[model samples]
Target: MRNPISGAISTLAARPLVRSALTVVTALSAVLFADALLSAPPAAAQQGFGNFFSYQAPKPRRTAKKKRQVDPAATQRAEPGKAGEAKKAEKSGPTQPVSIIVSLGDQHASIYDANGFVTRTRVSSGQAGHRTPSGVFSIIGKSRWHRSNIYSGAPMPYMQRITWSGVALHAGVVPGYPASHGCIRLPAGFAPQLFGMTRMGARVVVSPSDVQPVEFSHPLLPTPKMQEVQVPQETATQTAQQASVELASADVSPDKTAATETKLLNPIAFASVLKKRAVAEKAAASAAEKAALQAAQTAGAEARQATTDLDKAEANLKAAEAKAADPAPVPSAKVQPASQAPTDTGATPSPEEVAAQAEVAQAKAALEQARATKAEKSAAAFAAVEAYKLAAARAEEAGNLIDEAERRSEQVSVLISRKEGRIFIRQAWKPVWEAPITIRDPERPIGTHIYSAVEPSADGSKMRWTAITMPAAKASTSSSRDRKKSKTAEASQAAVAPPETASGALDRIELPDDARQRISELLWTGGSLIVTDEPRSPEMSENATDFIVLTR
Candidate 1:
């Protein structure tokens, strides 16, 4: 029913080429119309559709270049947190003995001197599996710009080793938590400062919680054996005046001399000197001891030889006496020589008898000579033996002196092991002595404790002690409420409570008289005594380290 014209349009639209031609012709006509308007005057374009259809291409961007410059000051300075570049040994630091306490609970470390607290800084301890052990340890070794032996040569600048089994304080990334491989990580700025302040054998107490050193005293604690100082003919004031005069003559300030004396009195400085002296004295004593022993052996051999000579002389004398007593019946007259005639009087002796008598006399003289020779040899041997004994005694005295020097030079370490039911003492990393000790109530746990002889009293008769008790490991069963309650109770407790607890431990312990005496004689400032429920740490090998007590 479509109209013929309409039919023709529909038929053309159905063909794709005819429809596309029509669309292009219509678009071209519209573009020509728009271009004509845009090219017209602005008033004409505004009146047309060109205003609504305006378009413009975007302009390209321009960038300015900068020239590079080098800064001399920046190049000379150490980069921030660069530990390797900061490796330096400070020439001056704390003069007295220093102690360090690391608290795993708060993740902080504090340094102390003979006087009191010095400083504290944040630290990063070990993570979950590789936990930093809680214990009383000492700085056994140190190195600058060290690398881990277990790990793949990871840098550990300003390393201060506490345990031989790889526990130490070193500079590394501290993420404010337990994140290290059983080592204590310190900040770059603090590590070098601490390293310079501390020395080998410095007591380092690593505990589960924060603890501080306090003035502690107990009757059972060993007191120093004070020796009387023998003054010279001149008084101390006179000696000082003389020294001042000498210094003045040398054009030196009195303060300079005083400073030199102070340096000499510094514990670390004098201790090192004493240690070297002790070693030399020990060597000399050993040589003297060996020589004296050899001399004794030689003297003993000579004594035996003299005895043998005496015996030989006695035998020879007896044989001669017997021959002389039974003078072979004067050989019958027929056997006698013609010149040898028997006298009628018994008083007159035969030539043969006279010859026998002369032979006996000669034997007597020879025996007497041998006796005198043996007497001289025996006296010489006795004298030599006495001389050896004197030498040996001198060597022993020298050894005792060396021991005294060593005790003064190095800190003494005492370990009271509840598991072993004994106490062990070490000096200069050597086993000085060990003895059985009785601990009351062995069944119940007494906990781990560290007591340090921080410094001597003004009178030098007693030492100021600081006690730190290790906290129990974090238990899954323990709740925050209980922890808080416990902490509150501890804080509220009387200050005397700490010293009582430490002294009470000493009361529970009973030492042999000799052990007590020896310990007293050796006790000095910077020494430490550790009481632990656990046995000796595996990190402690024979003659390799001080007493290592692992609380965990």
Candidate 2:
């Protein structure tokens, strides 16, 4: 209020200072309001995203458990109770040791037991041409009633069947030799006892010879003087004394006694005996010499006859060879030209008629050309026939060689039968108990047998590793089971880890390639994936994983 200019300057300064202070306070208040707004909870957080921004600590995770695997070998073993039952069944029977001997030579059967020989009976064997085989056999089965198809309504008595086929030993009239059509015929009366003595699975040996005779060469004839020796008769008391003496001397060598006896014999009588023997020997030698000479003459005559027959045979062979080598040649006819001049001199043709005749000649020339063409075709057909015959002969020769090779490589089939858990091997349809182990395939079908080398699966769960599709009619119950088992095994093998390579996997499997190809051809008429060399899509390529390649 003192000076106006100074007051105004002071006022301006004061006003500026006040304005600056007010700005500071307003900026501070705005900053405080912004902080409060940022601190408030989000609306989205209340709707279940609270943990998205929040930092709550995570709870510990629970551990997972692993599954256990089952053992296959332990599962395959038979149960204990069943095994005990099987053992008990095996021990419950009183086994009878019965035997039957059939002689192929006599065509008869003889039954025997521990007691002694049961009975001897007549029998009929195979036949004249189909002779019953000579070998050891065992009774495979027994039946009360049996009949023969080949024989006229003949009822087999005490029918003890030996083979699976109709072959058996039963009551009938024994032909004394091979007469029946493979059945061993027995005498009607002895049938009951024979049947009673034999068991279902008794051993039967049908051999060529039952008893073999001992043989020795005859000694030289005794001398007449040695044969004539006689001792004087003695009283019983004296004989007893002599016998005692002989018994005491019996310990001495027999050679010494023989020498003494020869010495005691009269030399004159011995000489006479030797002379007679020499005469007889001379006569015998002379007769043998004459007989030998006659035999030589007869042999010479036979040789001459044989030579004549051989010459005739050679002539016949030569004729046949010539016929085979050179076939008869066909005769051909020659064509002759028609006569130019007419035989009828009175008839003369006009110009028009002569023109017509000329045209006819031209037509005949054309027909001759056609005939030549036909002749050429006939010749070609004949040549084709000759070629076919030659080819057929070659094919026949190849077939014969194949047949001979197969015959040479023929092996006997080893059949195995498993009844009540026991195994048996058979050769030539006859059972062999002591058969070689190498010939037997333990993993083959339980009832059937085979001789070929059958390669089982690598794991041995299936009988054959390779797939063999047999005809439906020929399939047995066991074979059907085997096929099912093979399929299951194949599925199991497929379930295993995929093979290292596609080809390697194919090798482990069996597929009918030919049949599959045929089916593919039928479905895709024009072509197939196997035949085409085109690239496939991923889906199409996946099909290769399932494809299998089988080799013979």
Candidate 3:
């Protein structure tokens, strides 16, 4: 209040100091607020600032304390009660070669043999980001007491590999959920059982949800080339045994022996020779049978004619003898026939008596000739019948040989890839042939489909086929839990692409003439054909397997 200029300067300086103090206080309050927010529960923080400042930590519930007391290891392994069930599963093993179907939704695997269902068991598949793929696969490799190559030597006992890319079914702790890193985990006891039941090349189908194999029928399904003649089951069995013995005795490298055998006993060449021989033998049998029948009929007729002639000749001879012995009672005793009667009684001087004697001799000779002719004809007929039977037997034997040759040849698998524009053939997991194919529309997806030749058709004119259509790419989100998953899962479900139906898939492919012919010639019961828009999978390694489809 003393000087006006000095007071104004002091006021400006005081204002700056006040502003600095206010800024420091505001920064301190902000730091305290951030600390409170960081300390609050995540749920409370998400609720908003209204609760953020006032949030209070609640006391733990009794149930929470109880849960903590439980053994943590229990959640990391299979249920203790399941050990007995696993043992039971191991005892009732499959009788035939088995196929496996794994359902991601249920986390269970169902096994089947050729006849039908075998057994089912719990499994643990891949978790979250490392989701296991879904598609038709095959057990390409197996190992007991195996160790993971990618996971720092983690124990993977009784591992059966489906893909060379780290995917397999192995023994591990099954915690009733998807806890694995890509491989399917089985109960400790069940794993060895499955390993014992399975073989390399066994079919394995993994899907989003549980899907059953239905009795599917279609006309477009490829049929096996029917043999004109069917060989008996007995003959086929005998042939198989003989072949097994021969193969077992051979002491040579399998690869070299197979090649040599193929050349020496070429199925095609062997079949050709057998077929020709069968046809010729059948024709010869038919001719012989017909000739034998005709000969028998002619001989029978000749024998009857000869018998009749012999009887007639004997009757004539008897009549002639009677006439020669007692010439006609010549005129009877009353009419001057005394001279004629006396002359013919002792001497054969009368012309009528001499003629009757010559007639008797001729009749006897004709009867003897007829009897000899009948005997000769009967013997000829018997010989002809025996000859016909032998010829028929020869024909049947030729047909059996053809059937045996065919049975010895393994059933072949066929794959038609629209993307590759080619058809591939494999037998015993080895490539046999390949040829170009044509798709109706190269841009359109044909979808993956597996067609199996189940058995022969009713009339036996062709093979009966059953098909299995693989799930679409987005099918992995099929489970209810997966449906309610994060936005990524929902997007995947929303982008579900429709897969082609089994019949429709077959209709799109246009096989070349040679391919069709080859398929017909090689196809057999249990043989499979795969048609898809994708090219051959990398998993179908060189001379290692049939087609391997992956639908992720």
Evaluation by TM-score, superior candidate among 1 and 2: 1
Best by TM-score: 1
RMSD of each candidate relative to the true structure: 14.2, 40.8, 24.5
Estimate the TM-score of every prediction. Answer: 0.55, 0.23, 0.49
Write candidate 1's Cα lDDT for 133-159 as tens digits. 878888899999999998999999999
Q: Evaluate candidate 1 by giving its C-alpha RMSD to the native, one decimal.
A: 14.2
Query: What tens digits encode model 2's per-residue C-alpha lDDT throughout 215-263?
Result: 1111110111121222222222332354221111212212323332211
Instruction: After superposing candidate 1 on the true structure, give the runs of residues whose Cα lies further than 4 Å from its correct spot.
Output: 1-95, 229-231, 235-404, 477-500
Residue pairs with backbone atoms closer than 3 Å in model 2 (clashes): 123-185, 124-185
Q: What is the C-alpha lDDT of each candidate?
A: 0.69, 0.38, 0.66
Q: In candidate 2, how many Å is residue 532 off? A: 57
